[model samples]
Target: MTWLTALRALSAAATSENDLQQVLDLVADTARTLLGFDFCGVLTPDAAGESLVITGWSGLSALYVDRVNTDRPVRLDSGSPSSQAFHSGKPVAFRDITAEPEFTPWGGVAREQGYRAIVCVPLVAGDEILGTLNGYYSPVHTFTGYEIERLTLLANHAAIALTSAHRLDQLRQLNESLREQRDALTRSEQIHERLLGVTLRSGGLDGIAAVLAELIGRPVLIDDSRNVVLAKAGNDGELPDAAWRAAANIAAPQSSAPVPVGSAADPTRRFSVAIAKLSDDVAARIWFPARDTDLDPVAVRAVEHASIVISLELLRIGTAVEVEHRLRGELLADLLGSGAVISEQVLQRAHRLGHDLSRPHVAIVGALSVSGEPAETRLYQRSLSLVGDLVAPYQPRPLAAMHRGNIVTLWPITDESHESGSAAADLVQRAIGAVSRTVDATVAVSAQAADTATSYGEVYRTAKGALDIAVRAGRTNTVVELGDLGVLGLLLQLEDPAQLVAFARRTLGPVLDYDDLHHTDLVQTLRTYFASRHDRNRAAGRLHIHPNTVTQRLRRIEQLCSADLADPAVTLQFSAALTVQDVASLN
Candidate 1:
């Protein structure tokens, strides 16, 4: 091709092709065709900008190229002709490579390739030197001024074409990036819309989980504030133990963004967690195992969107649950009321709540033990959820509610063998045990089953009373059932606790007031004397006091109460009052 035609072809190829390497190849071929050189090469800077690398070449032996690239690549400071042309932004010529001192480093390469002379022309784009376009001749031929001018002219045009190709490549990459971003935004929107639809349909947590799993192509799960599995999608069995441990390490992400459970590069780091805040004190976490690979940015955003959906779903479910909880509490109050009648309206409400109060059922009450610090309401709600979840399998649909500041479950009896109610209480105790991690808890099961709702009041009272006395009796993290305590059954049955407190205060008022004023253990002394079976010496040893000191305290106690410890009825009165005082003081 003519030089002009060759320039036209180079410009056309540069403008049309977006690939940088292909443009470089075309430039190499065109330079060879016009200059009548045996070999041509297009060189670009290596990554460090320290050397000229042969990015594209024509008619060069692979062994020569390989030796130069791997063993002795020309660096900018190497004082070589190509480096000098690149650094100086001018054309450089060596009339005879074999005699050129600067070509010594590349001597073996040139000899092997059989080149006698070479020219290095800098490819200048505007003010910047891109790299060197080199041509090789097999026989000695000193470049004349005319020949140098032609090479320079061709090199200038080649620079424009290469610059155009580089810019086109950039524009193409930018276009692809924008397309990817647009598609990602579109995908995120679709995922968000689908998750929102699940919420609007009241599809519940399971629905949200399923949608999240499908969008991310990974298994998903939701755990409650307690780290117990609340719902699962794309999986049916237990997750890795590392998941729960990792979950415990990171606080729930405050926003919808998902927090990764493990290190980004760690293969063991398998789960991503997002918190669905229900209240300040309670939240649900949505998790997806990374499995073999981490989620992409779009998938991570999808998880974030899923978290919002989950939070909304949890709120909706929470509101509905709150309403049902109030209704259940009201119904439980009615059923457990002292003289509650089993009306049809009540039965219908019970059925609506999925409870069969007419069946043989017994009341079980789980009470939160009094804490030194006051408990927050959200803690109570979370604890109740845990308790309900634990008993759900046994009760199918348990009639449970927070009534009178206690969780009451009227569990249906599958076997009235009496032991079954106790066995059920054991399971309830385990469930309540989970709550104890946050706050202490106690469970009490009634001794009898109520065949109808009318009888529910009595059965519930038995459980409630035992739970009350159990908590007062310093029972925690355990089950308390009817018939377990001897006098507790009698104490709660005969009188309301208020009545007993009053009776104790009246009988022990003088001695307690005296002991308070003097910082004396008059009550302890009297109780120790009675507990030692009326043996003064043994009582003194038990009280960690001298026997004569105990005698002196007992005489003072008699003087304060104006009653003799020797009288049987007087002893009974003091003993009963002390027992009531002891039980009342246990908590």
Candidate 2:
């Protein structure tokens, strides 16, 4: 082809093609055809601008290309004609590679490739040199001025084509980015509209979860503030415990963005979590596990919309709970008051709250046994949730209320024929133990189950009295009842403090006086001895002493008090006196 026709072909290729590789290939072919060279190649600088890399070539041996690339880069300061032309911004020619001293460094390579002469022209645009276009000749031939001029013009066109290819690449990338952003905006709008429709239709948390699962094409779960699973959908039983724990940890922080869990590169082990805040300091969290973990931007937007709907549902449920708790607290306060009766209105209200008043019910009052520290608001809320969860499996649907610095619960007895108050009290203590485990507090319960309205009021008083006795007796995180107290309960009910003190001094005064005079612990030894049911080995274990030491303390106690060693009445009297002493000291 003529130079004019070659130039025209180069322009058409540059304007029509987008791939840089194809453009470079066309430049190499055109340079070889119009310039009448055996081989032609295009070289571009590497990222560090250190050397020219052979990016495109035509009719060149693989061995020559390997030598030019791997053996050594064509550096700007190297003796290679291409490097020389690129650095100097001009055409460089070696008339005879075998004899020319200027071609000494690359002469051996050209001779091995069967080329006796070579010419290299710099591909220049404005003042910047882009690369070098090289041509090889098999026999020695001097390049004419006309030939050099034509080659230079062709090199200039190659530079323009390369520059156009670079600009086209940048424009293509920018267009892709704009398209992605527009698609994302459209997806976000669709999710917003769907969630808004769900809200307008009063679709609850279950509906919201169903919608989210459908949108993300993954399993969805919503957890309340207490970590109780409120709603779950589309989980095919493939989720593990670790996934749930990871979701909980992510949802603990109130972030608006979806926090990804597990290895992000491995979709089977990855998921996401988001939180939605509710009223009354409650929060609902949405979890998207790795059923279909390749969630796109649209799925993420659906999770956000699901979170909003969950927040609204949680607020609605929390408001209703608050109203119910308030009404239950009012009813409990009236029922426990003096001269209160179980009237028709009270029974109807109890039924509304899912409690049966006609059945035998256990009245339980619980208090934390810490001195001078009332429960914080957060602890109270946690305790309420825990108690509700604990009572859910039991019968008669217990009513729990926080009343006057205590947690009061009314649990019904299902079996009237074989009503066991002890079993009911055990359950109450177990429930309180669970609450204490969650709240970092030692809670004690006083329980009394009865069948009559008058008996409920009396049991309430009895439970209160038992609680006071348990606190003073150094019991914590346990259940206390009137039957367990024995004589101590009767003594606690005694109206006069002076008489109670007199009863204590009369039964155990000698041992107390001996301990006071000699600085011994005879009174404590007697108290522990009776607490362990007079078992010397068990008492020794409690006192962290040898069993023989307990025997010695008991002998000393009997000698000091001059009391009989084997009298049931004396043991009972002395135990009651010790309890009375403890109660007096607590006051």
Query: TM-scores of the models, in the given order?
Result: 0.68, 0.60
The candidate that achieves the highest lDDT relative to the unseen native structure: 1
Output the lDDT of residue 36, model 2: 86
Report clashes for each candidate as comma-separated counts. 1, 0
Q: Give the deviation of candidate 2 from the true structure as CA RMSD.
A: 8.1
Candidate 2, position 347, lDDT: 82
Predicted candidate 1 versus true structure: per-residue lDDT over 260-301, tens digit per residue: 665434455556677777556446777776565777898888
Cα lDDT tens digits, model 2, 116-163, are 878889999889899988888899989999889988998998999888
